[model samples]
Target: MIQLHDKIFKPFISSGELDETVSNMVQEVTKDLAGEIPVFVAILNGSFMFASDFLKKYPSNCEISFLKLASYEGTSSTLKVKQLVGLNTSLKNRTVVVLEDIVDTGNTIVEIADLLANEGAKDIKIASLFYKPEVYSKDLTIDYIGMSIPNKFIVGYGLDYDELGRNLPEVYQFYKQTDK
Candidate 1:
């Protein structure tokens, strides 16, 4: 359990479950990019841990890069995406995969795809460790989805609350205590 500020969070996804899910995701990603070497552009701050573990499991010939984007203030999405850092490589005619920690409102994803497209990326795919279908409002197809979960607030394995809990090996969700 993790207590941050006034919130109490209990373990939701254990380390074993997370590893298994990531293992399966790696298989799917390899199969999808079998013929092409894709450049994995990891969204920084959140995807650092996921990207590290994913690349270790993925034994394919690919390139890795990092770019930082922000859309969240506290635990809620601000609905406006801003790029803190830019991609350095030329993605012209290259297959690009956007690796994200979570996909909620899909605002950040839209901006990522648009930027890649404008830079002449031949193909773009979205890969995320977690997704909330209920909250996703964008008309975009998430190519790789690790798990489908509710819109509950979560933290761990790179997901953080107020810049904390990212080092946790497992994912956790806020627990509400009602009067009994």
Candidate 2:
């Protein structure tokens, strides 16, 4: 177990597992977007590691950009999604794929999709490293999912607890027993 601020997290997903998942997702994405060069817009901070690994394994040529959004203040979501950094790239009439670290409430995904749609994107697809279907309430579809995890707080592999544990190679779930 590891401590981040006042919270403790235990190993959940290993580094190898994450890598394998990413590789599989890349294969699937490559097949679907075979002819067209899609623009990958990665959500910043949490998705930095996943985006890097994903882009590195992507076999075909693609354009990449980043947008930073925020909703979480600690272990819980603030229930408000704010776009901290806006997109500068022209998404007009382009096939755009959004890369996210995790999708639970799906508010951020909704916001991004709306923004892309307003920009007149030809098509929009959402890709996430981790997904919690139990808590996802958005009508939008997540096209690519690396892993479907339980509704639990996790850190590491770009996910964090109070801005810590992002450097950890493996994913860790919050340990309820350690809260005391």
Candidate 3:
């Protein structure tokens, strides 16, 4: 169990499970991009750890980059994606894959796809580690998904609450707030 801000969140997804899931997803993604070497653009802050693990099992020749976007304040989605860091490479006629930590309202992924399209990327694929189907509102198709989780606040493995507890090895859920 992990304690955060007076609340205790039991382990929901262990590190081993996460690794196995990622490995499988990487295999699927590599198969999908078999003919082309795609440029993986990782959404920063949250997807950093997931991106690293995923690239290890990708089993293909690909380039990696990072794009930082922010859309959350605390544990709730603000429904707006703020692009803090921009893509430095020209994606014209290039196959690009956007790696994300979680997909909630789908605003961030949609925005990223649009941006890449505008920059002349030939194809765009989205690979998310976690997805919340209940609240997803975008019409875009996610090319790859690792897990579908309930609409609950989660932290750990690069996910955080109030910028704390992201370094935890496993994913945890916040059940409820405790009295301080």
Each prediction's TM-score versus the true structure: 0.95, 0.97, 0.96
Steric clash pairs (candidate 2): none
Using lDDT as the measure, what is the rank order of every candidate, best first? 2, 1, 3
For residues 134-164, write the lDDT of model 1, one tens digit per residue: 9999999999999999999999999998898
- Candidate 2 has its poorest 10 consecutive residues by lDDT at 171-180
In candidate 3, the residue pairs with backbone N, CA or C atoms under 3 Å apart (3 or more residues apart, or in different chains) clash, namely: none
Q: Per-residue lDDT of 55-174 in model 2, one digit per residue for the tens?
A: 999999999999999999989999999999988899999999999999999998999999999989999999999999999998999999999999999999999988999999999999
Best-fitting candidate, scored by lDDT = 2
Task: Give the runs in model 2 whose Cα sits over 4 Å from its true position.
Answer: 177-180
Model 1: residue 16 alpha-carbon error in angstroms = 0.8
Task: Quote the positional error of residue 55 for candidate 1 in Å.
Answer: 0.3
Find the number of clashing residue pairs for candidate 1.
Answer: 0
TM-score of 2: 0.97
- Is candidate 2 or 3 superior in TM-score? 2
Q: In terms of TM-score, how similar is model 3 to the real structure?
A: 0.96
